[model samples]
Target chain A: MSGFLTLLKRDLLLALREGGALGTALGFYLIVVTLMPLGLGPDLNLLTRIAPGILWVALLLAALLSLPRLFEADHDDGSLDVLALGHMPLELVAASKALAHWISTGIPLALMAPILGILLNLEARAYPLVIATMLAGTPAISFLGAIGAALTLKTRRGGLLLALLVLPFYVPTLIFGITSISAALLSPAGFQASFLILTAISLVSLVLGPVAAAAALRQHMQ
Target chain B: MTTDAATQTWTQRLANPTRFMALSGQILPWLTIAAIAVVLYGLYLTFFVAPPDYQQGETVKIMFIHVPSAWLAMMGYLMIAISSFGLLVFRHPLADVSAKSAAPIGAAFTLLALITGSLWGKPMWGTYWVWDARLTSVLILFFLYLGLMALRSSLEDETLAAKQTAVLGLAGVVILPIIKFSVDWWNTLHQPASVVKIDGPAIHSSILVPLVVNAVGFSLLFFALHMKAMRNEVLRRRVKALRMAEVEQAARGRDTSSATAG
Candidate 1:
């Protein structure tokens, strides 16, 4: 347990100290949301209606932008090899890195969604729901993205491939996240159902991501 | 105990790639003939025997192909998942070949399902596409197949690629049910109350017979293609191994000549 926390802390520190990774994802999120209005006229009502979708989709893309670096830095510097040899199991090691990714990248992206929501002229009522869904949803993104990151750990120019591999898995999260917010905005009752399902997706990925990523990582190490 | 020993030896014999190649060679021709015969018979029944639907008319005929292809598409993925299990857990040599060969065939069937589905939709639904639950799930399945193929092709090491692909395949198997469920839920949330279901309540015997026949025919075809593909992969690997051996030998000859000169 201490090893898990230590690895998580170390990864969080590396992400913060590294400087550009988080910024690039945030910048990409901002740009994607910013471009939406220009692309589809400055119709505030139209933007308001589509705001939840645009926010969630853009957040997913932004999260994807940071995924490739989740394991690459450690894999490159021989730290991953040392981690593999450590007392902590590789599955927990993977889980920690993924949790760190959620803290460093996923949380920030979710938090930024509402701010971007303003640019889209999002409904005031939907703001809290958007944050709620995103917070519940992004853990799945980080964890599932960990599998992609680990799978492509040794591939040259793996970013695009990782996106292809991971994005399909993101559909459930994207669906539940957007729908929960939309449900809350349209009707009060359906929101809880979708939100709970969204949280369920995160829990599933939390277990799945580490086990699968560890298997992939073991293959790479071999 | 003697019967158990005999069964073990039988499995051991089949596990040998050379033996597998010889056995499959004998079976391939007969399997091909059976598949072709059944498929032709199915098409005959589809065109000549199966009556046009009361509601859909001739466009309903597309179900004969579309339904079967969709079944095969899902079945192909299951085959890959099982083969991957065999490769990863049992360490079966042929399992990797089976998994690799199943991917493109599965992907092709998925594409066939999508195309046929849309073609049917244009006439029936009055649109080329709708984000219907089944369509969406199959589309995601197609992407998963593409992901598996792309991951395998990008990695250069054959052994490592096999293991990695197997890992991804198994993960995909676990996620498929969740993806299906979420897509279904999302569809229900967005869809209008009066939606047109493709398979209307209790298919009639006339429609059911041809659909089942085509399904069986297509499944046979899928296995034949898989067997042939495995053969090609086995032969390809042998050639690669022989080439590597040749290079090693040539390098050794040069090293000996240089040593004598020195």
Candidate 2:
């Protein structure tokens, strides 16, 4: 457990020190949200109706932009090899890195979402729901993204390939996140069910992601 | 001890790629003949014997192809998942070949399903597409297949690629059900409240017979294609190995000549 925490702290420190990745992701999120109204014409009613979807989709893409770096940096610097040889299990290493990714990248993306919501004319009441659903859903994104990052660790130009591989798995998370927010905006009754399911998806990915990422990393190490 | 010995020999024979090549060689012609014969018979039945639906008329005929393709699409993924398990857990040499060969075929069938489905939808649903739950799920399945193929092709290392692809395939299998469930939930919420549900017509004996025949025939065809693909992959690996050996021998010759000069 201490080993996991150390690795997590190390990763968090690296992300903060580097700082550019998180900034680029947030800027990308802002750009994508800004482009939507221009593309569709500035119809406030339409923007309000589709705000949850735009926010969630753009957030997924933003999270995806940083995914290829999840393991590439460690692997390239040879720290991954030392970590692989450590007392800690590779699965735990993967989990810590993914958890760190969620903290450093996912949380910031989720928090930035509500602010971007203003640009899309997102309903005032929906802001809290959007923030809540995104906070719950982004862990699944980071965790699942770890699997893609690990699998593509040795590939050339892996960013596009990682997107293709990881985005399909994001379907359930995206569906639940957007639907839960919409349900809350439209009525109170359906929101709880969708939100709970979204959280369950995050938990399931939290477990499955690390194991699968470890398996892929092991193959690459071999 | 005798039974154990017998089982060992059986598995050894099955596991030997050379023996597999010979065995599949013998089976291929017969499988091909059977698949072609059955498919022709099925198509005849579909066209000549079955009556058009009362409601859909000619458009109903599309179901004969569309449904079977969809079934193969799912079955193809199942085959890849099982083969991946065999490769990863049992270290079966042929399992990777099976998994690799199954992907393109599965993807092709998935594409067929989508195309036929939309063609049917245009005449029936008055549009070429809708975000219907089943269609959406299959579309995602198609994307999964593409991802598997893309991941495998991107890596230059064959052995590592095989293992990585297997890991992804298994993850896909685990996630498929959740994706289906979520899509269904999303569809229900967004589906227009008053849209009349169009339940499928009851399967009459006439329609049922042709459908079953086509399904069986198509399944047979899928296996034949898979077997043939496995053969090609085996041969390709053999060629690669031979080329690698030749290069190694050439490099050794150069090293020996240089050593002698030194």
Across A91-170, the per-residue lDDT of candidate 1 in tens digits comes to 99999999999999999999999899889999899889988899999999999999999999888669999999999899
Docking class of 1: high
* Candidate 1 clashing pairs, residues 3+ apart or interchain: none
- Which window of 10 residues has the lowest lDDT sum in candidate 2 chain B? B188-197
lDDT of 1 at B167: 93
- Predicted candidate 1 versus true structure: per-residue lDDT over B24-131, tens digit per residue: 999999999999999999999999999999999988889999888977888899999999998999888999999999999999999999999899989888888887
Mark the 10 consecutive residues where model 1 chain B has the least summed lDDT.
Answer: B188-197
User: What RMSD value applies to candidate 2?
Assistant: 3.5
Write candidate 2's Cα lDDT for B171-245 as tens digits.
999645643354445544222211112564457778888888998899999999999999999999999999999
Please give each candidate's TM-score. Answer: 0.95, 0.94
Q: List candidate 2 segments past 4 Å from native.
A: B1-5, B9-12, B178-202, B257-262
On a 0 to 1 DockQ scale, where is model 1? 0.84
